[model samples]
Target chain A: EDQVTQSPEALRLQEGESSSLNCSYTVSGLRGLFWYRQDPGKGPEFLFTLYSAGEEKEKERLKATLTKKESFLHITAPKPEDSATYLCAAAGASNDYKLSFGAGTTVTVRA
Target chain B: GAGVSQSPSNKVTEKGKDVELRCDPISGHTALYWYRQSLGQGLEFLIYFQGNSAPDKSGLPSDRFSAERTGGSVSTLTIQRTQQEDSAVYLCAGRGGQGRSGANVLTFGAGSRLTVL
Candidate 1:
């Protein structure tokens, strides 16, 4: 079974603080790795999709990097609005799009 | 219309009652997905529908959980004889693309919060 594990279950940071969340995985064959941001009471919003090692993608204050065994989401100078649970998922070798997700890291940015 | 939408934002039901949740994907989207989120658990994939083909229901936990997509646009998930463990937020998403690598980003709905007592 493909498995995803995220570190630092909860993170608290002051406004403008920078930190990184980690997502490690083990799968038979990796088709894609995905990053999503979810707010309380809402569904997850897609952030980035990394297909190979050394691949990186960026948004306003977030950067996602993927390697053979893991993916990382780095938040730079985060604001209160940036606070949300970060989710990481891995799609296996099969054509099916079933994604195995990690428990997620809850981030709270204080103003 | 613009994004994936789910109906009945909140549902409170008796433990033995059945509940049906609905999802309306963005117009023209070819793929639809269902997931459940418990208090501390991560998002759990429940089922997936693509075009007019058979759905992938491997993620469903039991026979009590079933879903159907109609007209390739609207989908419904029906849970029979709900249990306390069934209390969670159910989310839906839509995707479009010919392949996994080319699949468009998934757009998610606000989710339906189901509380069984």
Candidate 2:
């Protein structure tokens, strides 16, 4: 089965602090790796897509990097608004390109 | 609409009662998907529709769950004889009709929170 696992189920960061969240996946013929941000009571919002190893995408203070076996989302000088659950997903040909999302990493940034 | 829109933002019901959740995807999006999010579990895929055709529904957990799309725009998910375990946030997403690459470009709604009593 295709699987996406995230580390540090929850993280607490002070204002202006920086950190990174890990998402490891095991999918056959991986097609794309995606990042999403979800706030409480809201659905997920797309962040980036990494189609190949060594690929990276950035938005504001968030940067997403991909490797063959894993992906990383780095938050730089995070603000309270940047605090949300970060989700990672993997889509592969074997899985019909359906996204399999990770449990997610909840970051709490206090200002 | 501006983005995917789901109706009945919150629904509270008793066990065994049936419920229907609705989703109006972004205008012109031909790909639609439904997912379930439990308290501690990851997003669970339920179904996908590509221009009114369900190419895959293997993600649906049980027979009690069924969904349909019309005019390639609005969709509905109906749960028959609901159970306590069915309580979760049902999310709806949609994207362009493009091929494989477009499959990952999904736009989501706020989701409907279902609570079973």
Give the TM-scores of the predictions, in the order they appear: 0.95, 0.96
In the range B7-81, model 1's lDDT, one tens digit per residue, is 999999999999999999999988898999998898898998887564588889999999998898999999999
- Chain B structural similarity as TM-score, candidate 2: 0.94
In model 2 chain B, the worst 10-residue window by lDDT is B96-105
**Model 2 steric clash pairs:** none
Model 2 compared with the native: what TM-score?
0.96
For residues A1-109, could you state the per-residue lDDT of candidate 1 as single tens digits?
Answer: 8899999899999999999999999977788899999998888999998888999999999999998999999999999999999999888776437788899999999
Q: What TM-score results for chain B in every one of the models? A: 0.93, 0.94
lDDT of 2 by residue, B15-99 (tens): 9999999999999998899999999789999999988999989988899999999999999999989999999999999977555
lDDT of 2 by residue, A65-86 (tens): 9999999999999999998999
Whole-model Cα lDDT of every candidate shown, in order: 0.89, 0.92
